[model samples]
Target: MKSYKDLSKEELLQLQAALEAEYEDAKSKGLNLDMSRGKPAASQFDMEMDIMDVLNSSSDYKTAAGMDCRNYGLVDGIPEAKKLMADMMGVANADNVIVCGNASLSIMYDTISRSMTHGVLGSTPWCKLGKVKFLCPAPGYDRHFSVTEHFGIEMITVPMTPQGPDMDIVEKLVSEDEAVKGIWCVPKYSNPQGYSYSEETVKRFAALKPAAKDFRIFWDNAYVVHHLYEEKQDHILDILAECEKAGNPHIVYEFCSTSKVSFAGAGIAAIASSKENLDDMRKSMTMQTIGYDKINQLRHVRYFKDFDGIEAHMKKHAQIIRPKFEAVLKVLECELSGLEIAQWTEPKGGYFISFEALNGCAKKIVAKCKEAGVVLTGAGATFPYGKDPGDSNIRLAPTFPTPEELRAATDLFVLCVKLVSVEMLLAQQA
Candidate 1:
C-alpha cells in the first residue's frame, strides 16, 4: 500500500526480494502469453462467423446499381461500401471515399509514398524537395511514424495532451514552416492512450493557414467506432466538415476500416478526402491496379449492411473484449494504486491502455515481463522510431488474450513494475 518512493533502502530490498521470488515462480509455471498487438480474440471472430456465409456460390455478385463485383470496374470502391465507409468516417459525401484493401496502414503508406514521388495536389514531390518534415504526436501510433520515416521525411515530435496534441505548438509549426507538410492524428479512441480530440482542437486544425499549400492532416480514425462502453463513448468533431467550413476543403485525409469490425486481415479499408485530393489519388490508383477486391467489398457491404449494422457489430466486440479491459484495470488498481511509481490511462473505449512507469523503468519492466514468459508491445513502440525519450511508456493490449490469460499477463506486469520500481529506488539510495 506504500508508495515505492517512500520506502527505505532496506524495505525496498525486501520488497524486491519478494517480487523476484514471485517472478521466479511465475516463470516456472511456463506461462507463455502474448499481448503484443491489439488483435481480436478467437471468440470475437467466432461471433462474426456468419459473415463468411453472407455470400456463397449460389449468391448474386451484382451491386444494387448492377455493377458486377466479379468484374474489374469500380476502381475506387463499390457505392454501398463507400457510403458505409463515408458514414463511418463522418464524411458527408460518399464521392470523397475510396475503399482500399483490408489494411488502412497500407493506404497510409501509399499516401506517404505518393507524396514522396508525386507530391500532394501538384506540389513538388517530397523527394525532390531540399527538406520535408511531418509533425508526430508522441505516445502516438508507431506505424504512422514508420510511414513518414520510410519516405526520408523529417519528423518533429509534438507533445500529446488529453484533448489532443498540444495545439499551440501544432499551429505554430504548421503556420511557420512550409516543410511541415502533415500531422498524424488518431482523433477518436487514439492508439495507446484512447484520447479523443476536442472540438476546439479540431477547429484549430481546420482553421490553420499553413505555410505550405499542400499541408495536410493525415487523420487515422481507426477506432472511430471502437468503443468499450457504449454509453460512455467519445465523439470527435468531423475534421473534413470542419475543414470545409473553414475554407480548407483539401486539408485532411480521413481513414477507417472494418479490420476490427470483421476479420482483422480480411476486412475493408477506406480513405475520405476532398474531391480534388480523391481525384489526384484516383489517377495513381488507376495505374496501381485495376481495382481492389470488389468482391470482398461487396461481401462487407452485405455482411454489415449499413452503418447501424456496423455499430451493432462493434457493440458485440465490446461485449467480448470489455471484460478483458476491466480485468487489466482491476488488477492494476488493486496492485498499483497509491504506489506513486506509476500512472496509467483508463480508456472508456479502444483496444489499448497506456501505462506510464517510473522514469527509466519501462524497458526493464517490459524485459522482466518477457523473461517471465509474457510478451508485451515493446517499450517506446508508441513513439516515432520506437524511442520513448523518457523510457517510461508501455502500451498494454487487452483484446488479444482471453480473460484468464489477460489477468495472468497483467499480474506478471504489475509484479515486474513493483520489482523494477524497487530496484530503481534502491539504486538512488546508493
Candidate 2:
C-alpha cells in the first residue's frame, strides 16, 4: 500500500471520496461498539466466578492470624492480606504495603488529596503553595492526568521512550522547579504504550534530588502482573527497593489492585511505600473511616494465597485477553502497515495499543470512527487536561470487546484513519 502523502492531490481527493462513501455505508449499518476504556469483557469474568466461592457462607470469616474479618478493626488491612499484596508487588516486607478498598485508583486519589490538604510528611500543603505541577508523560494514563488536573495542578507533558518516560527531562524539571511536586508513572506494562522502565531509568528516578522536598512519584503498577506473552514478558525494577537503596525511601508511593485480575470494581487494592509514608497516610486514614472492608481483604488473601496463585490466575487472564489484543493488532497490521501516515505501539502485556495517526488527523479520525458506529477514547485523553498537542495519539482498548467486535470496530477504525489521512493530505495540497 502506497503512503498517502506520496499520492498526487487528485489521487488523494479520489481516495478520500471512496473512503467517505465506505464510511457512510458503515454508519448505515448502525454498528455500535465501544473501545474506550480498559475494561475486561464479560467472557473474561468466567474464570473469576470461583472468587465468589472463596467466601461462601460455609467458609471461615476469620483471618489466618485469627482476626475476625466480620467486625472491622484492622484499619491497615488484615495481616494476611498485607502479605499477599506485598508479595504481588515484590516487596519483601508486608509492613510497607497497606491494603485498601476495591480500587487502587481510590487509594491514589486519597493520597493526592491528603498531600493537597496536609502535605507530605510536614512539607507545606500543596493548596498553600503558589503553584503545583506534575510531570505527565504523554501517551500516559488519562485517569492519572485527571487526578492531577482535578487538584488544579499544572501538568507538563514529557515524551515517552521505549524504555520509559524521558527521565533526563524528568530529572531536570524536578531539580530546577520547586513547583514540580510530583510525576505520574505507570512503571510496568504502562497504560497505552506498555513500555516498562529500564533498570537505569528506575535508578535515575530513585536517585533524583527534587527541588521540592515533598516531591513524590505516583507509581501506578496497575498492570505489573498482566502479561500477554510468556516469552516477551517485561520486568520492571521494584521502585520501593530502589528508592530505599538510594536513601530516598519516602520519594515513591506505588499502587496496585486486582481490578483487572479478578473483578473490575470489587477486587482488593494496595499502596506500597516507606513505613514513614504509610504512617503519615495512616493518621489521615484514622479520620477517614472506621476501617476499609476487611472481609473483602480476607477474601482476596484466601483466594490468591500467594504470588504463585496470582500468577496462575493472571495466566488465565492472559489466555483470554491475548486473543483480543491479537485481533485488533492483526487488523492494524494488515490495513495500516507501510502507510507512513500513522504509527502504533505493539504492546506485549498492557490493556491498550497506542496508535499515533498523522499530526492533526487524530480528532477527525476519532470523530469519523464514532460517526461510523465505533467509539474510541476521545483523541486527547491519553494526555494531560484532555489535550494532545499534536492531536496524534489515540489509545485503543481491546480488552473490553470480544474478538469479533474488536475486528469489526478496528476495520472501521482503519477505514476512518484512511479517510481522515486522505482528507488531511488533500487539504495540505490545496
Candidate 3:
C-alpha cells in the first residue's frame, strides 16, 4: 500500500473524492455512537454484579484486625485494605499508605488544597508564595491540569517522550526554579497515551533535587493493573523505594484507585508515600473528618483478597474491554494506516488511544464526527487548559462504547479524518 504522502496530485484528488462519498454514505446511517470518556462499559461493570452481594444484610462487618467497620475508628483505613492497596501499588508495607475515599481525584484535590493553605511539612503555604508553579507533561491528563488551574497555580508544559516526560528538562527546571512545587505523573499506563514511564525516568524523578523543599511528584498510578493483555503487561519501578534509595524519601505522593477495577464512583482510593509525608497529610485529614468509609474498604478487601486476587479480577475486565480496544485499533489500522495524514499510539493497556492528526485538523475532525452523531473526547482535551498547542491530538476512548458501536463510531472517525486532511491539503495546493 502506498503512503498518502507519496500520492500524486491526481491520485490525491481521486482518493479525496472516494473518501467524501464514503463519508456521505456513513452520515446517512444516522449512527449515534460515543467514544468519549474512559468509562468502563456496562458489560464490564456487569461482571462485578456480585460485588454488591459481597456486603449485604447477611454480611460480616468486622475487619481483619477485628475493628468494627460500622464504627468510625480507623481514620486511615483497615489494616487489610491498607495492605491490599500497598501491595497493588508495589510498596514495601501498608504503613506507607493511607486509604481514602472512593475517588483518588478527591484525595489529589485535597492534597493540593491543603498545601495551598497550610503548606507542606512546615514550609510556607503556596498561596503566600509569590508564584506557585507545577510542571505539567503535555499530551497528559486534563483533570490533573484542572486541579492545579483551579488553585491558580501556573502550569509549565513539559514535552513528553515515548519513554516518559523529558527527564533532562524536568531535572533542570526542578533544580533551578523555587516556584516549581510539583509535577503530575501518571507513570504506569499513563491516562491517554498508555505509555509507562521507563525505569530510568522513574530513577530521574526519584533523584530530582527541586529548589522547593516542599516540592512533590503527584504520582497518580491509576492504571497500574489495567492491562489489555496479561502476557504483555508493563511494569514500572516503585517510585517510593527509588526515592528512598536516592535519599529523597519525601519526594513523591503516589495515588491509586479501584475506579476502573470496580465501580467508578464507589471504588476505594489510596495514597502512598514516605512515613513523614503520610504523617503530614494525616494532620490535615484528622481535622477534616473522623474517618473515610471503612465499610466500603472492608467490602473491597473481602472481595479481592490480595494482589493476585486483584490481578485475577482485572483479567475479567480485560476480557470485556480488550475487544473494544481492538475494535477501534482495527478500524484505525485498516482505514488510516497508510494515510500520512494521521498517527496514533497502539497502547497495550489503559482505556485511551491517543491520535495525532495533521496540524489544525483535530478540532475539525471532532466537529465533523459530532455532526454525524458520533461524540469524541474534545479535540484539545489531552492538554493543559484544554489547549493543544498544535491542535492535533485527539483522545479515543474505546472503553465505554460497545464493540458494534465502537466499530461504527471509528468508521465515521476515519472518514472525517480523511475528509479534513484532504481539505487541508487541497487548500495548501490552491
Candidate 4:
C-alpha cells in the first residue's frame, strides 16, 4: 500500500474518483449513525439491568452508619459510599472523599463556580481579578474546556505529547503567571487520545511552583478502571499522594464516577483532595443543603460492595465496548494505514479514538461524513475555545454504536478523509 503523499497526480485522481463513488453509494444507504459522543451503548446498559433490582421494597433503607437514607443528614456522603469511592480512587482514608451527584462533571463545575465567586481556600476571587486563565492541553475533554470558558476565564492551549502535556512549557507558564490558576488533566486514559501520563509527567505536575497561591490541578480521572484488558492495564502514581510527597498537599483535586460502571445518570460520583482542601470545600457545601441523595449513595455502596466489586463490573463493560472500538480501528487500519494524509491513535483503554487529518481538513472531513449520514465530534472540539489551532484533530466515539454500525460509519469516515485530502492537494497544485 502506498502512502497518499507518495501518489502522483494521476494516481491521486484515480483514488479520489473511486472514493467519491463509494461515498455516493454510502449516502444512498441513508444511514443515520452517530459516532459523536462517548456514551455507553444500550447493550452495555441493558447488561446492568440487575442494578435496578439491587434495591427494592424488600430492602432496608439504612446506611452502615445507621442513618436513614430516606431522610437527608449526611452532608458529604454515607459512610459505606465514601469507603467505596475512596478505594476506587486509591485513597487510603474515606474521610478525604466527598461522594456527590450522579456525574463527576457537576461536582467539577461547582468547584470552579465556587472558586470563581469565592476564591479557593480564601485566595482572591477569580471574577474579581483582571485576568484569569487555565491551561488546557490540546486533544483533551471538551467539557473541561467549556467549564473554564463559561466562567469567562482565558484558556491557553498546551501541546499534549505522548507522555503528557509538554511539561517544560507548563512549568514555565504556570510558575511565572499568577493569573494562570488551574490546569485540566485526564491523567489516565485521556479523552479522545487515551494517552496516560507518564510517571515523570505526574511528578512534574506534583512539583510545580505556580505563581498563584490558589492554583489547583483539576485531575478528572474518569476512566481509572475503564480498561479494555485487565492483564494489560496501565497505571500512574496517585496524584493526591504524589502531591503530598511533593509538599504541595492542597495542589490537586481528583474526581471519579461510576457513570460507565452502572447506569449513566444513576451512578455515584466523588471528589478526593487533601484535608485542607476538603475542609475549605465544606464551607460552601454546608450552606448549599443539608446533604445530597444519601439513598442513592447507599444504593451504590450496597450494589458494588467494594473495589473488587467495581473491578468485576468493569470487566463486563470492557467486553461490550471492546468490539466496537476494534471495529473502528480495523477499518481505519485497513483503509488509511500508511496514508500520509492523516494519522490516528490506538488506545488501550477509554471511549474514543483521536484522528488527525491533514491540517485544515478536519472540519471538511467531518462535514463530508455528515453528508454521507455519519455524525462526528465537531473538528475543533478537543481544544480550548473549541478551536484546534491546526484544525486537524477529530474525536471518534465508537462506544455507543454496535460493531456493524461502527464499521459502516468508519468506512464512510475514511471516504470523507480521502475526498477532502484530494481536494486540498489538488487546490494546492492548481
lDDT of each: 0.92, 0.91, 0.92, 0.90
Across 348-392, the per-residue lDDT of candidate 2 in tens digits comes to 898989999999999999998887788999999999989899999
lDDT top scorer: 1
Point out where model 4 deviates above 4 Å: none
For candidate 1, give the lDDT.
Answer: 0.92
User: Which tens-of-lDDT digit does each residue in 62-180 have in candidate 1?
Assistant: 99999999998999999999999999888888998999999999999999889988999998998899999999998998889888888888889999999999999999999999999
Could you give candidate 4's per-residue lDDT for residues 1-430 as a string of tens digits? 7877777888888888988888889899998999899999999989888877878988999976678898878888988999999999888789999988899999999999999999998898889999999999989999999999998999999999889899999999999999999999998889989999999999999999999999999999999999998788889888988998999989999999999888898899999999889988899999987898887887788788889999999999999988888888888888888878888998989898899999999999999989889999998999998888888999999999888888888888988998999888877766
The TM-score values for the models, in the order shown, are 0.99, 0.98, 0.98, 0.98
> Per-prediction RMSD in angstroms?
0.8, 1.0, 1.2, 1.0
Evaluated against the true structure, the overall lDDT of model 4 is: 0.90
Worst 10 residues of 4 by lDDT: 421-430
Q: Kindly report which residue stretches of model 2 are placed more than 4 angstroms away from their true locations once superposed.
A: none
- lDDT of residue 164 for candidate 4: 87
Once fitted onto the true fold, the runs of candidate 3 whose alpha carbons sit more than 4 angstroms away are: none
